[model samples]
Target: MEIQKTPLKDCFILKPDVFRDDRGLFYETYNQKVFEKITGLKIDFVQDNQSVSSKGVLRGLHFQNGEMVQAKLVRVVKGKVLDIVVDIRKDSETFGRSFSIILDDVEHLQLFVPKGFAHGFITLSEQSIFSYKCDNYYDKASECGIIYNDATLALDWHLPKEEFIISAKDLELPSFEEAIS
Candidate 1:
């Protein structure tokens, strides 16, 4: 796998070597050795989560606070999505900065979002199957989110504002300023 670091610290885009044949293809999606070599951080993913969403569906801008903060390894299995991560660590140099990438089954690429960042995605195809590994388990009380379309963040989701569809909870999420205040 080729791990490419994004502008945001600790965020990575991994391109796996896919071996194709007349039947299908295979690739080593995750290997601890390679991961450590690339990121210099050792992670032991304790939980795996999967979700299915239709086009126009947007999931998050979510993260956990306190000790439950998580690092995620995310990929798309059946379709495509616009995955995004925002650095929220108050002490980090790149705080408030965000990164976005296109993850698709055909590319077999994965995204690694370290703890202290907010993670989210928007399905780009009719249907998308998303999977991820988290270093920590879910902690509802510690979970928090920023509005996906927060003006200060100024994210260009590649979709028009009127066309972007999101859940009621996400829509009700506070802006970055509001949340921080």
Candidate 2:
């Protein structure tokens, strides 16, 4: 596995070594020892989650606060997506800044989104299978998210704003300023 750092602190892009044969292809998505050695992140993911969405579907900008915080390792399995992450830690040097990357089935790349950040993705293919591993079990009371299109951030999702299909639940999320404050 190769660990690539992003501008946001504690975030990374993990590329795995793939072996292709006449039968098929194979790669190790996560190796505990190697993960700790390369990223210096001592974490044990307790729950695995998957979401399937169609083109233009936007799911997040979501995170858990305080004691329910979660760190996620995410990847795309069946299609393509533009994954975005924003640092929301009040004390983080890169607070409020965002990072974006293309995660696709072909490349088999993964993103490590540590606690103190909000994460979201937009599908660029006909359909996408997005999966993630979370270090902490979810807590309803602590769940929260900032609006995906927070004006302060001005994120360029590479898709037309008019084409977006967001949930009413997500549309009502607070702005980044409201989240941090």
Which residue pairs of candidate 1 clash? none
Model 2 residue 30 distance off true place after TM-score fit, in angstroms: 0.6
lDDT string, candidate 1, 106-176, tens digits: 99999999999988999889899999999999999998889998989988787666767798988888898
How close is each model in CA RMSD to the real structure?
A: 1.0, 0.8
**Model 1, total clashes:** 0
The window of 10 residues in a row where model 2 has the poorest summed lDDT is 156-165
**Per-model TM-score on C-alpha atoms:** 0.96, 0.98
The lDDT per prediction is: 0.91, 0.93
Say which candidate scores most in TM-score: 2
Q: Give the C-alpha miss distance for residue 41 in model 2, angstroms.
A: 1.4
TM-score, cand. 2: 0.98
Q: With candidate 2 superimposed using the best TM-score fit, by how many Å does residue 79's alpha carbon deviate from the native?
A: 0.3
Q: Which stretches of candidate 2 lie over 4 Å from their true place?
A: none
